[model samples]
Each structure stands twice: as structure tokens, then as C-alpha cells.
Target: MFQKILIANRGEIALRILRAAKELGIATVAVHSTADAEAMHVKLADESVCIGPPAARDSYLNIPALLTACEITGADAIHPGYGFLSENARFADILAEHKIAFIGPKADHIRIMGDKIEAKRTAKALGIPCVPGSEGGITDDEEALQVAEKIGYPVLVKAASGGGGRGMKVARTKADLSDALAMARTEAKAAFGDDAVYLEKYLEKPRHIEIQVLGDGKGNAIHLGERDCSIQRRHQKLWEEGPSPALDDRQREDIGEIVAAAMRKLGYIGVGTVEFLYENGQFFFIEMNTRIQVEHPVTEMITGIDLVNEQIKIAAGLPLTIQQSDVRLSGHAIECRVNAENPENFRPSPGRISYYHPPGGLGVRVDSAVYQGYLIPPNYDSLVGKLVVHGRTRSEALMRLRRALDEFVIDGIETTLPLFRVLVRNADMQNGDYDIHWLEHFLADGGMSAQ
Candidate 1:
């Protein structure tokens, strides 16, 4: 195990890494932007350093500052929790040059899986199914139109290097294809610095599912089951659950094993998620997240494994302790992303939180960095926390989520608490009958109005 680890991110995820490292007898160093000086993670770390100013480019995303902090603090490893530079392949290579381990997948894997087009090819080569579309990068409008027609209507034009629902556009008819293709490429270039885009047949009403896998980069890997993340808004997942209501036991075993096998074949390292679009009893590979996911807590609730702990250990050359047969889903788990935004308009709500009281009870957990008087800086993502709940059954989990949402209190700001409160009682949500586009349509149609 590493003697010391530096968390190269902020907010709840940084705190999440800090606690896991501490539990494993590893010292932690917290690096923060100027705006996050009073963050809970900074307060709890063994030592904290101010990396840069409030701007992410000058702060958390600054490579030199992060490495300098590790150099000064003698942290041998850096854990990039989720966003920022977590999935950046170049950042991983830089850590290697400094002899500091990046507690995630290898740089090569990150680069390969980062590109959506290449990821689909890899999945197809590994015998994992992929959505039918263009062969590779489509630059010719005529060729794109041909692929679109062959794949049928409602095709999705996606960025080869896209993520977070950016750099993607949908065209329901042939007339909408050319503009969608051009716009997707433009957005992809601006967002990811890559102008390449591809096409795929858009499957209507598919549940977004992802399989979590941990690998040692030494021919050993294990799958920790799956998470249903179909409840989304503008392609961003809002609520996630484990042991998808859409899948059966046989479906789970088949897909989980296939994911583990693919990881072993690819020599994948650390923690990663193999995302898929499941529809009509078929699982089609979408993309792979080369780092820990925000909804990981839901998987942790079902399985008694600490994913962060395993991620750290694997990066240090330790093999997995659990096997395929050892992994088991105990119960139902749910995670609602609590963002600092208006529940109705979804506009950002960043300011001083005057009063903060999180819900507490059996099977309720909130991973957050906010306090009664903490001033929420507006320079970063709108997310302020995550509410994770577990229950013996899916029905019980819904009940617990409802009660917990009612008890959660935060003043001086608008939160998605009201949205979650409304969603918990939603018949469709309760029945687990929602697709990726369901939330947006629901919100637009007064689902978020009076609530």
C-alpha cells in the first residue's frame, strides 16, 4: 500500500478518498483551490495545500501545482476522484514521469477508452455488442447520411471524444441529419479538442446500465455487479439504483461475466465502469468510464466492498481479494445526486448555506462537503452532495428515500431536494419504468413545477 496519497480533486469525492486512505493506514494530503480553503476534506487531511486560484484551469486542473503538492508533501500516489483530470490520459502520463502513481486506470487504457468511436470498436472486437452505425469517423455528409439511412431513423450523432452528454445531437428525421452532424463535431472540438464525431442508431427507451469492474493490470479482474442509471436529465444521471429492475438473474450473470472477461482481455487496471444501453433484452456497449463513478456508493451499499480501497490497493500492485462467485448483491440501493440548483429550472444555486441538516436513519448516507455556514463557491460543478440509501428490498428503499428527502434541510439556497421528493412519489419512478429521456420530458411537463 502507498504510504501517502494526494487527492487531486475537490468536494465530497475528495473527502471520500481521504477517509478510505485513512482507513487503510495511508496518510493523505489535500490540495484545494483558493475558494475551497475551508472544505471539510482540507480540514481533515493530514496536510492541506492551496494549489491555485478559484479557476479550475489554474487550480484543480493545474498539473504542475498538483505534482508540486505531491512532491512537497511526499505523497507517492494521487487519487483523482471523478471529474477534472480523473479520466485525462495525459495527466496519468505526467504522474508516471514524476514517479507518482495515478490511482485509476493506466494511461493507455484511458486514451483508448476515452474515444467513443474507438471504444465501440474495442467492445465489438471483444465480442461485446455495439450499436450499428458508421464504421469510424464520419467526415463526409453524404457518407453520414448513408449510414443514418441504413441504421434507420432517429440516429444519434455523437462526439468520438465526448462525455457528460456534451458533443451529442439527435436527429429524428433525414432532414435533421446534416446540421446535427456539423453541430456535434463543433461541440466535440470545443469541449474535448477533437472534431471527430460518429453515428449510432438511437435505441428508443433504453435503460442506462453500467457494470463496475476492478482489475490489477495483471490478468485478474472482477465485476461488482451493475447500476441502473436511466433516470437522467439532458443525459446526466439524476437517480441511480443497483440490480436493475429491467434485468433478471440470468441477464445479470451473463453481462457481469462478459464485462469481467473483457477487462481481463484488455489488461484494464484499477476501477472502471462499462456503460451500456439496455433495451429489448439486449445490452449494447455505449462507453467506458475510466475512473470511479459518482453513483459508486450504490454499488458499495449492495456489495460489502470498498471500491476506493480496492482501487488504491490495485494501483499499488495488490490483486483483488474477491472472486466472481464471492460477489453478491445483498439488497436494493439508491443514490440521488443532490446538486446546488433550482429543482424546477435546474439553474445553479451557489451561495452561503445558512442552515444544513442532512437526513439520518437506518440505510441513509449523505456524502457531502457543505456545512451550516459554508459558502458554496460558484466556480465548479453545481453538485453539493449525494444521498445514498439502502434497503432489504426495492420497495423499502423507495420508502426510505421518501422519508429521507423530507428530512433533508438546507437554507439560503435552492436544492434538488424538492425534485427528489416529487420523484420518490412518482409512479413511473417507483415502478422503475423510466428511460434516459424520461426525466427531461417529465420536468418539462410540470413534473418539477408545483413540487
Candidate 2:
């Protein structure tokens, strides 16, 4: 076991890793930006260091500063809690050169899975279902257009190095393909510094389901089941739940097997997610996230696993302590991303939180970093907290989530709580018949327009 670990990120995830390490008797060193010097994670960590200015590029994404912090603090390992440099293969390699363990997948696996084009090829090689599209990266607009035509009328142009909904464009006709392709490439180049783009047959109204897989270094891997993340806006997940309401037992087993096989084939280790798009009762591989997901708490709630601790243990050369049969989904769980933004216009509202009151009860858990009088900086993501709940059934979980959302209150900044309240009460959401476009259409049709 590592005596000390440096957390290379901030917000609730940093605090989450800190708590897990503390339980395992591991000291934690938190590295934060100048704006987050007084953040909760910094206060809770055994040691804290300021990396750089408020901008993420100069701090959280700064490899030299992070390595320096790890060296000075004598951290045996570094835990990047989602986002920033968590999935960065170069960072992993740098840590390995320094003899510091990166608490995630192997550097090679990260490199392979980080590229969408390579990931699709990998899935195909492993016999996993992947969307029909271009065999690999399309080098030019003509190549993109040709691929789009072969894939049929509706095609999606995506960045080879993209995630989080950026660098993507959907074209419904041949006339739209060239422009969409150019736009996608430009966005990808600007966002990831890679001008590569690929094409895939677009599946309209597909449910975004992902399987959470954990592996030990010895090539053994198992999945904890799936999370239905169809509730999203602009490619960002809003609410996620376990044991997808749309999938049957057979479907679940099939998808889980495919994900596990892929991970094992790649020699993947630690915590990761294999995302898929399910449409017309068929599942197609999309991409893999090489780090802990924001909605991971829902999986833990149902499976009774501490993913963070497992990540650290795996990095420390510990084999997986649990087996596939040992993992069982006991109940339904849901997580609502509480962001400090206007529920109406969806604009970020950053300011001091005059009051912070979190809901608590049986089956309800709140993962947050804010306290009363805490000032939310305008420099980063507007997410302030997450409200997660579990229950014996989907209906029970929904009701519990509704009640919890009502109880959550954060003053002096706009939040999505009001929007969530309206969402849970909608007919489609209540019936569990909602698709990826449900939220967008709902909001466009005056769901949040009223207030």
C-alpha cells in the first residue's frame, strides 16, 4: 500500500479520494489552483500545495507542477480524480518515468482507448459491436464526404480525440456532410490539438448506457453493470441510474460480457467505463472513459463497492478482491448533477453561497464541496454538488430523488434543482420512456422557459 498519494485535481472528487485514502490509512496531498487555496479538499488533506493560477491550463493541466508537488510531498502515487489530466497518456508516462504510480489504466491502454478511431478498431477486433462507419480517421473533406455517403444519410462526424460532447456534428443529409465535417475537424483541432475526425452512422434517440469495469494488473476484469445516462443535455449527462430501465436481463449479460472482454483484451487496469449507444435493442460501442465518471457514485451505491479504494489498491499491485459473481445490483440508484447555473437559460452563476443545506435521509447521499459562505469561482465548471439516492426499486428511487431535490437549497447562485424538480414530474421521465433528445426538446418547448 502507498504511504501517501497526491490528488491532482480539485472539487468534490478530490475530497472523495481524500476520504477513501484516509480510511485506508494513506496520507493525502492535495494540489489546487490559486483560486482553490481555501477549498474544502485542501483543508481536509494532510498537505496541500498551490500549483498555479486559476486557469486550468496553468494548474490542473500543468504536468511539471504536479510532478513537483508529488516529489516534494513524497507521494508514492498520484490519483487524478476525473477530468483535467486524468485520462492524459503523457501524464501517465511521466509519472511512470518518475517511479510514481498513476492510479488508473496503463499508459499504453490509455493511449489506445483515448483515440476514438483506435477504440472503434479495438472494439471490432475484440468482436464487440461498433457503429458502422469509416474504418479509421478521414484525412480530408472529400474522404469524410465519401464515408458519410457510404454510412448513409444521417452520419455523425466526431473528433478522434474527443469526449464530453465536444467536436461532434450530426449531418442528416449529404449536402450537410462537408460543412459538418469541416466544423468538427476545426473544433477537434482547437480543443484537442488534433485535426483528425471520423464518421459514424448516427442513431437517433439512442439511450446512452455505459458499463463500469474494474480490473487488476493480472489481466482479470469484471463489470459492475450499466448506468443509463440518457438524461443529458448538449452531450453532458444530467441524471444517471443503474440497471438501465430499457435493458432486459439477457441484454445486460451480453453487454457486460462484451465490456469485460474488451478491457481484458486491452490489459486495462483500475477503474474505467465502456460507453455504448443502445438503439433498436442493439448496442454499439462509442468510446471508453479512462477514469472515474461523474456518475460513478450510483454504481457504488447499488454494488456496495468503494471504487476509489479499489483504484488505489490496484495501483499498489493488489489483485481484484471481488469476483464477477460477487458483484450484484441490489437496487436502483440515481444521481443528479447539481450545477450552479440558471435552470432557464443554463448560464453559469458563480458567487458566494449565502446558505448551503443538503438533504439527508435513508438511501440519500450528497457529494458536495460547498459550505455556507463558500464562494463559487467563475473560472471553472459550474457544478457545485451531486445528489444521489438509492432505493429498492426504480419508482422508489425516483420518488426519493424527487424528495431529495426538493430538500436541497443553495442560495446566492442559480442552480438546476428547479429544472430537476420539473423534470422528475414530467410524463416521459416518470414513465421511463425518455431518450437522449428528451431533455433538449423539453427545455426548448418551454419546460424551463416559464421561469
Candidate 3:
């Protein structure tokens, strides 16, 4: 077992990892920037180290500073709690070279899955279903046109190494293809420093589904369940739920087994998510997140598995503690990502939180690091917290989420709480009748005003 672990990120996820490490009797070292000196994770850790200045480049993303902190703290492992440097393959390799364990998958796996193009190829090679698209990156404009025509109209031009919808553009007609390709390539180059782009046949309406998988880096692996993250705005998921209304029991098991078998075959380790676009009773592989996902709590709520705990154990060279049959999805779970932003414009709103109150009850859980009087720094993500709820059924979970949203309060700053309060009451949301683009369309059509 690792005697000590250093957390390499901040906010709610860092706090989440700290609690899990404490439960396993492991001492934790929290690294923070000058801006986060008063952060909750720093205060709660066994020891804290100021990495650098406020800027992420000089602080959270400083690899050498992180290494120095580890050396000084005598920490044997580093747990990157999503975002930041979590999926940086070079960081993992450097840690391994220093004989410090990274509480995630192998460097090679991270590299393979980090690139959207390579991830698609790997998924197809593993017998996982994939969307029809170009075999690889399209460098020539003529080749891009040819691929677009072959895939038919309404093809999506995507960056080979992009995410969060940064370098993606939709071409609805032949005239749109050239512009879409140019825009996507420019965005791809600016966002990821790579101009490589690919093509895919865009489905008119699809739900975003991802399978939660855990592996021991041996030939052992298991899939907890699937999460339906269809509710989104500008490709950012706001609401997530488990036991999707779109899938039946047989379909769920089939996808879960396929992902688990693929992980076992690859000798994967730690936690990973295989994301897909589901439409017309089929799932098309899109990408793989090699680190814990922002919506992982939804899966944890349904499976009753502490994923962080399991991830730590796996990093400590532990074997599979539970079998596939042992894994069970007990109930329906829902998660609402509460961000510090205007409900109407979706702009960043950061300031001192005058008064704060989180929802509570038997089936409700709020993951947040903010408190009354806490100054939310504008230098980082605008996410204030996550409100998660679980119940015996999807309808009951929806009811619980509605009640919880009503109780959630954060004063002295704008938040998306109002947006959620309205969403929970929407008939489409309540009935699970939504796709990835549903929220955007709803907002455009004055759904919030209607509520």
C-alpha cells in the first residue's frame, strides 16, 4: 500500500480524493497555488505545499514543481483527480521514471485513448461498435471532401486530438463541408496544437452514453454500469443519470460486458470511461476518457462502489476484489452540475459567496468545496458543486432531485441553480425524453421563460 499520496488538482475532486485516501489510512499531501491557499482540500490534508503562483501554467500544471513537492513530501504516489494533468501521458511516464506511482492507467493506454482518432481505431479493433468515418486523419482538402461525400451530407468534422466540442463542426450540405473543414482545422490547431482532423456521419439525434469501467492492469476488469449524459449546452453535460430510459436490461448488460471484456483484453488499470453516441438502438464509439469523469458520481450512486477507493487499491497492486456478477446496479441516480454562471447567458460568475446552503436528505449528496464567505477564484473552472440524488426508480430520483434543487442556495453570486430548478420541472426532462442537443434547443425556444 502507498503510505502517502499527493493530490495534483484542486476543488471538489481534490477533496473527494483526500477523503478516500483518509479512509484507507493513507496520509495525503495537498498541492495548491497561491490562489488556493485557503481551499478546503489544502486545509483538510495531512500536509500542504504551495506549488507556485496563481496561473495554472505556473502552478497546477507545473510538472517540475509537482515532482519537487513529491520529493520533499516523500510521497510514493500521485492521484490526479481529473482535468489538469490527469490524462497527460508524459506526466505519467515521468512519474514512473521517478519511481512514483500514478494512480491511473498505463502511460501507453493514456496516449492511445487521448487522441480521438487513435481511440476510434482502438475501439473498432477491440470489436467495440464505432461510427462510420474516415479511416484516419484527412490532411488534403480534396480527401476531406471525398470522405464527406462518402459519409453523406451532415457529416461532422472533428479534431483528431480534441474534446469538449472545441474543434468540431457540422457540415449539413456539400457547400458547408469546405467551410466546416476549414473552421474545424483552424480550431483544432488553436486548441490542441494539432491540425489533424477526421470525418464522421453525424446522427440527427443521439444520446451521450458512457460505460464506467475499472481494471486491475492484469487480465481482470469489470463494468459498473452506464450513464446517460444527454442533457447538454454547447457540448457540456449539465445533467447525468444512470439506467438510461433509452436502454433495456439486455442492452445495458450487452454493452457493459463488451466494454469489460475489452478492458480485460488490454490489461487496463484503474478507472476509465468508454463514451458513445447512442441513436436508433445502436451505440457508436466516440472516445475514451482515461481518467475519472466529472459525472462519475452518478455511476457510484447506482453501483454502491467507491471508485476512488478502488482506484487507489489498484495503484497499490491489488487484485480484483469483485467479480462481474458481484457488480450490480441497485437504483436510479441523477447528477446536476451546478456552475457559478448566469442561468440565462451561461457566463462565468465568480465572487465571494455570502451565504451558502447545500441540499440534504436520505438519497441526496452534494459534492462541493465552497462555503459561506469563500471567495471563488476566477482563474479556474466556474463549477461550484455537483448535486446528486438516488432513488429506487428513475421517477423517484427525479422527484428527489427536484426537492433537493429547491433547497440548494448560494447567495452573492449568480448560479445555474435557477436553470436546474426549471429543468427538473420540464416535462421532457422529467420523462427522460431528451438527446444531446435537447437542452440547447429548449433554451433557444424560451423553455426557461416558459417555466
lDDT (0 to 1) per candidate? 0.93, 0.91, 0.94
Following a full C-alpha superposition, what root-mean-square deviation does model 1 have from the true structure? Answer: 0.9
Ranking by lDDT: 3, 1, 2
* Candidate 2, superposed: residue stretches over 4 Å from native: none
lDDT per residue as tens, model 1, 327-405: 8899999999999999988899999999999999999999998899999999998998999999999999999999999
RMSD for all candidates, in order, please.
0.9, 1.1, 0.7
Clashing pairs for model 1 are none
In terms of lDDT, which candidate is strongest?
3
Q: Name model 1 segments beyond 4 Å from true.
A: none
Query: Which of 2 and 3 is ahead in lDDT?
Result: 3
- lDDT per residue, candidate 3, 1-451, as tens digits? 9999999999999999999999999999999999999999999999999999999999999999999999999999999999899999999999999999999999999999988889899998898999999999987878988888787878999999959998899999988888999999999999989989999999999999999999998799999989999999999999999989899999999999999999998899999999999999999999999998889899889989999999999999999798999988988999999999999889999999999999899999999999999999999999999999999999999999999999998999999999999998888888889999999999999987877
lDDT of 2 by residue, 53-164 (tens): 9999999999999989988999989999999888889999999999999999888888988999998998899878998999999888788788877779799989999688
Q: Show the lowest summed lDDT stretch of 10 residues, model 1.
A: 442-451
Weakest ten-residue segment in model 2 by summed lDDT: 442-451
In order of appearance, the predictions have TM-scores of: 0.99, 0.98, 0.99
Worst 10 contiguous positions by lDDT, candidate 3: 144-153
